[model samples]
Target chain A: MIKELLTKERIIIPLTGKTKEEILREFVDHAKELKLIDDSEQVYNRILELENIGSSALEKGIALPHIRDNIIRNIFVLIGISKSGVDFDSIDGELSTIIFFIGAQRNDKKYLPLLSKISQMCSYGETRESLLNAHNVDEVMGVISNWET
Target chain B: MILKGEKRILIPIFSEKDMLYLIKNIEKIDTEGKEFILLRLIDEQMTKNVCQRLRRDPEEYLSSIIDSAWNNLYYFQEELTKKEIHSKVSLKTGNALNELIDFGKKTKIKVILFSRLLDSGFEGIFKEKLLKNLLISWEETIIII
Candidate 1:
């Protein structure tokens, strides 16, 4: 599961962006096509759905959006970084430049393990710091693959 | 454009059981593409007054998640029985609206089908205007239940 969930396909860091919603929308659309997700309305609703409930923002300009809707099989992750910052509706009222799209299947056990794994990845101070410093695709990919070595 | 030739269809399931139920009807659904996605929503018991009745028990919560997800995939073989649709499942957490939109955008999903939570809190607040902002401008399909 981690092999498929943490592949290079969904990792994007050092992403350039100017708008809050535009960059995120672009990130989401790209990830969906490869996976063949057909519930745009449901997907859209779930994002706004989470916002109304609470923002998924984390510390030091990071936000993990984990919505437990079985839109795609298994847990999906998309890593996006915006140097310019974004209005992420965060609880801290800070500009969110980095976002990770966390998708999970609640009915089964994948959500928790992946969430723990992702959460474990997030807890790494060095990982977050480099992911923030990554200047290009290779640099970003390096930060994404840091967990191994 | 990467999936320009991929076949797309939205399979929205309520609970974990809903997915197993759909397996019985997979043959009738159109599956003429290389990939078929089973978009299932983990409908939490959330009303206007969520009440926090389901207190956060980290271990138990995680256990339930694992149980459902494993079973869902184990039984989705029928989804592949229909030729052309390469079946796969995605799991999301929390409310349906945000979960669906995030899934749609991240997956570049062309369509969305969802069940409307007709609770009192959703009355005038959630309408088409809100949906416009929530949904990506890409081609989409909406099924309101």
Candidate 2:
């Protein structure tokens, strides 16, 4: 399921941003350029609202910043990797290097399962390290697609 | 990893003993400069025993028990907030172990703190099951007793 949504156009290697907000805006703008979403500012605001509720920074330098809004027609994904890492307000207090920006419908059934799959894929250190060093989208997808659980 | 600033603690509240244990241990932790979040999960399975023993409707029993649990949680939240710790509580239904894993994955959790019942009874059995599942599901995070 994750592999299907993740295409070459959706992946951003060596994301150019310094902070979490900047990274999110860059992802949204990138998605807009790909014609995946219509509005960038609206989506960015919604993501910030979700962050106000709670930070999406997972352990081991991974951040899944997502939003379920009426504007999102399908479960879309935008992947970003930063070797320098950005302060994403993670509970572990570590900088997040891999960022998964998810936009889904409000009542989408596939949202939670997709999140679960991604979380499991990122649980292993080897997979995360591979994702960090991955040069392209296919390499990133290879790491996630080949992972068990 | 390096959990130096904000700390997210997952607390699974099973019985009064678990609640008391958390309250007692909260003071001992060095929560001086770092922000703290107390993610409390009120297990629905623990209330199932009460429903079976009392012979009440499952829905009604769950609602009543959850209300009581919220009261206790709100009280704890108020007290913890006084100590500069943010408290967020959730009422979980179905398998307690699976629910904990789901909640842990959904949130950015750093540490999990649960109580071990000192006796070889239902509490001990329940804690063991939860601990086992937690160990299998959450390998990166820290677990505290």
Candidate 3:
């Protein structure tokens, strides 16, 4: 169910951002370009607000920043990989290398399950490494599909 | 950040059953002006433990756990809301003990509550160390399991 939303076009390989905001804006811009959102500014602000609720940073260099709004039609996901990692105040106090920017509509039923998928996928050290080494979108999708299967 | 002089209680939930049991126990409390937060830990690293030892699909294993935790949280939240009890639910991924301690200190928790389940006995040594570490970190907070 989650794999359908994580297409190659929705992915970013080797994201070029030093700060959390920059990385988030890059992803939000991608979603905008895809026409997934009506207003990028509103979606960006909403994502930041959700982030402010708590540091979405999990362990093992992964952070899933998710927000649900009525403005978006369906769930739009953007996966970004950063080798240098950014300090997003993760609980483990480690830099986050893989950032998942998830924007879901208020009525999306699969939202929670997608979050569950991200949580489960990021839990594996091997999966984290695989994501970091993924050179392209297909490789990233392959890594996720491996777990899904 | 924790507010100045705000008393809070921390409950770490593992499953819907665990949360239901905890809620049943908590129903006896006064809970007039106190705040409660239900925390569900989705430890991703723990999946490695399952994959290596149990030789199972870590994603499916963790997904079931996440689903159960959220479902239980939703049920408990509805019950609390009906009773007019102020509470919040939190979901995070990491070690349960470390996250508990971190959250307790950050929220200035006055007490930490847990629903005592049957002991595994196999992980006695690890559980002892975790308990000792948690107690040592939050010496002033009362721990009720």
Check candidate 3 and list the clashing pairs: A123-B44
Local accuracy of candidate 1 as per-residue lDDT tens digits, A1-149: 44456666676665565654565566667667766356655765666555433345544566666566677566677778878777765433567766777666657556656644554455467887787787765676666565645
**In model 2, where do residues sit more than 4 Å from their true spots?**
B1-9, B13-124, B128-145
Better of 1 and 2 by DockQ: 2
Q: Distance from true position, residue A73, model 1, in Å?
A: 3.3
TM-score for each model: 0.46, 0.58, 0.66
B10-65, model 2: which lDDT tens digit per residue? 77776556676777776565655444444445456666785687788878776555
Report the lDDT of model 3 for residue B30. Answer: 56
* DockQ, prediction 1: 0.02
Task: Kindly give the stretch of ten consecutive residues in candidate 2 chain A with the minimal lDDT sum.
Answer: A50-59
Model 1 misplaced regions, further than 4 Å: A1-4, A14-20, B1-145
Ranking the candidates on TM-score from highest down gives: 3, 2, 1
Task: Please write out the lDDT profile of model 3 over residues B51-134, one tens digit for every residue.
Answer: 678788887776676766655654575466546565656666578677877777776667776666433542333345556777
| DockQ scores for all predicted structures | 0.02, 0.06, 0.15
Instruction: Specify the poorest-scoring 10-residue window by lDDT in model 2 chain B.
Output: B33-42
Candidate that would win on DockQ: 3
Q: What are the lDDT scores of the predictions, listed in order?
A: 0.55, 0.71, 0.72
